[model samples]
Target: MLNLLVIDGVLLFLVTITALAVIEMRNLFAVTMLTGVYSLLMAAVWTNMHAVDVAFTEAAVGAGISTILILGTLVHVGVKERRREKSLNLSALLIVTLTGGALIYGTLDMPAFGDPEAPVQTHRFQKLFDQNVGKVPVTDTHHVEAVAHGAEQHGGEQHGAHEDEFHGHVYNTVTSLLADYRSFDTMFETAVILSAGLSMIMLLRRRSDEEIEAATQRTERVDPDTIKTERMDPKTTQTVRVDSPPGSDSSGADKKLAAEIAEAVDSAEQIQHDAPEETDKGDQV
Candidate 1:
């Protein structure tokens, strides 16, 4: 008992210190790493308390895959904290304090660790072992007749079916509980993990409208004909040229548009009145 207390005290101290350090950390990446360490410490505490299943879950989920997932998220979201203001929000602090107090109050009713007289050991385990071993007739005689009658109604074939469920029984009771008794819970946990992975995939994909539009525009080829070279009157196809003489305060845009129009007109004239000799020379070339 003394050794157990010492181990628990040390693990609790480590967990508390790691948690406080995580809270005090300004770097998000460092915080993430400290949070994993905190989880590992909690797993150590659970292992010391002989809760190997819970310890395995904490180590694999809380410390292992969860840390990797958070780091992957940080790759895109970045590790820097966006500090908009240094002032602490009183309302947030009040909410956190109230929530923490409520949680602490709730833990008051929990049984002490490894208490042999706990309800689980007395009620659930006793009933399970008694039912399996067929010892002590499994009753205090108050409802013996009722229990016998119920057993008669639900025994034999039902009991045989239950035994058949574990036809190749294993040594591990936890395995049997998870695979046989609470199989649906195990299945649902698997489904939840799959759904979370799908959710992460969906979130990490750059699927926003703006991002899609930018990618499309970046890859699109713009045609020269699609570009507006001259300012045209909406009512007519004629180009609107500036009448100001060469060196007035006319804008470069207006000059470029005028030059474009003049070049277009000259090209059309040349195409319409080109000499047959020039055409034949072109054809020969």
Candidate 2:
């Protein structure tokens, strides 16, 4: 009993320290990891108290699912938390104190740890154990042997009869209680776990606004003729040229040809006018 108490106290102390560290942590990534550690410590505490079902649930959801969800969120939102300088609020402290006091007061009514005569043991479980005990064989032969040995060490007779009596019986009372007596509760817990998993999937399996916009932009239809090809010079800014389709004339070359044709036409007209004047002058002479 002293050893159990000592281990429980040490585990409780570690749990408290981890919780405080999580609270004081400013980096969200560290906080998330610490939260997982806290849940695992809590699961250990529950296992030590013989609440294996609760421990399993805590380890799976709190340490596994919840940690993954938080890490996913961290990947999206980044690891740093924004901090603002401000004076402490007395009201908040007062509220926290009152809540803590209420919780402590509530624990006062609970039975002492491992109290064999607790109401739950004497009233709630006695009948359940009577109904289902010894239905399944204790799987571990070592445990059976140990029990028989302990009985013999205590100078108790009929060790063989005790072994025979407990033959084919499950050694774990918790399993029987959960599987037989509180099956409905376990079933509901499973349902809750499924629901929570679905909720996390819905929350995490999402496309962000930026991602949606980028996809939309990628799939947007652009006219082939409207596409602009751009080239940049180190000294110049934002120069663009239109792309010509295959077999199409280059715009710059086309403009140059037009200018040459107009200039040739104008020069030929000038020569024709000058020739007429020259011919008139020769006839007059």
Candidate 3:
């Protein structure tokens, strides 16, 4: 019990921290990750509270789908988060808090946990669930391992005789509430997930390499250095045509003469144009 309480307290603390982080984080990706953490903590709390069905749905929808959606958004738009107005939105917060306070006050008359008179674990709740949840046969107690070579398998006919002696309810109420009672909610949730997936595909699907190469070629025409830096072609031992800034002659032939410079450039151009395609390809690379 103490361990459970400690876990619950930790979950509450983490929930608050996630709230603060989501509010304060400048990076949208960090905000999304913190939201996922919040969902995980909530799932843990649901598991601890004996609500296995709720825990499963929370873990799947909140942590799994929510995180995926947020991550998709971050991937396409980048992690930048726009800052909210500096002025406090106090009026809106005050109205919300006041309404919440009123709701909390109304909960004062609610039954305490594990109260004997509470309807949660009673005949009435069972009857209500039975009326709504179309019955499925008791599957969990069907000795799932009985199909394998075992004593139970040998006594398959006897299994029916023993079932009545130790019967368990097949219609779990919480599971029914999630799948049947709120079926539309789950359907809409599925729709939301589909929408997110479609949006991400439409938005973030990267341009093809051919398209990227075309764009790069365009950029290079406007400004050629945008392409890759040149390097020496090892095959033919040719130094690639890498640009050097004016007046910074690394060749050390500057003082030789302007005539020598023009002649060398023309000769180099001629060699480049006349070279075999094999050598030229290596030089381009």
Candidate 4:
């Protein structure tokens, strides 16, 4: 019991620290990781309290699946949380404080841990257990004696005689309650988890081929008029012009550019033609 208490205390401390770190963190990715750490610590605390089923669910869903989903969301929303002016809202703070106080006050009236005389233990469920669920075979003599002693205290001579035959349906009451007595509750909880996973998958799914094609078409439809030439150096006054395609609409600037290009090409041909004749005349001299 001492070891369990120490473990629970350490786990709780770590959980608190992780929760605070997550809240203070500005990076969404870091917050997501801290939240997973918080869930893992909570799972450890639950396990220390012997709530294995709850611990397993917390570890698998909260730490594992939830972290992955948050990461997927971060891919779209970005990893950095937007900066906001830090100011405590008095109304929100008051509401949270009252809610927390109410919860703590409510727990004050609840029974202590493992109280055998608690309402739940002494309830009509005991009769149901005695009728439907038979005694679990006890290998430990101490446990058997304890069961016999409890039966005698309850004034059940028959229970004491057949204590071994009148044990719980399952050794673990939590398993019995979740899997048997409240099966429908468990089923609905499972359905809710399944629905949440499906929703996350749907939200994070890749764009379809049709959507991608439509985006590509929109991109291709960009106006050619929006295209502009890079600014030339100030030392050069001449502007570079694009050669318009044949039979395409041409501006006055383009037509002048085409004419200048044609004249330059003719002058280059004339120079080439005279070059061979000049070479022949030099050879004769």
TM-score of each: 0.58, 0.55, 0.49, 0.56
* lDDT measured at residue 221 in model 3 versus the true structure, 0 to 100: 24
CA displacement after TM-score superposition, residue 51 of candidate 3 (Å): 1.5
Q: Alpha-carbon error at 132 in model 1, in Å?
A: 3.2
Whole-model Cα lDDT of every candidate shown, in order: 0.67, 0.67, 0.62, 0.67
**Ranked by TM-score, top first:** 1, 4, 2, 3
Candidate 1 structure lDDT:
0.67
Per-residue lDDT tens digits for candidate 1, residues 67-178, read 9988988997899887775557788789999999999998789788678888888855743433342322224445535445555576422222233333335666677667
Task: Write candidate 3's Cα lDDT for 70-90 as tens digits.
Answer: 797678789987776764688
lDDT of 3 at 181: 58
Comparing 2 with 4 on TM-score, the higher-scoring candidate is 4
Tell me how far the alpha carbon of residue 75 in candidate 2 is from the true structure, in angstroms, after superposition: 0.4
lDDT of 1 at 266: 73
Q: Candidate 4: which stretches are off by over 4 Å? A: 124-173, 197-285
Ranking by lDDT, best first?
Answer: 4, 2, 1, 3
RMSD of candidate 2 to the true fold?
Answer: 25.7
Model 4 poorest ten-residue lDDT run: 228-237
- Better model by lDDT, 2 or 3? 2
- Tens digit per residue, CA lDDT, model 2, 1-285: 789878989999999999989977889999999999999999999998888888998999899989998998899899997777344568878999999999999989999867888888786465355543332244544454556556457554323323224332556766766776578998998899799889977877555465455445543422222223211221111222333442233344434433554465567678878887553355442
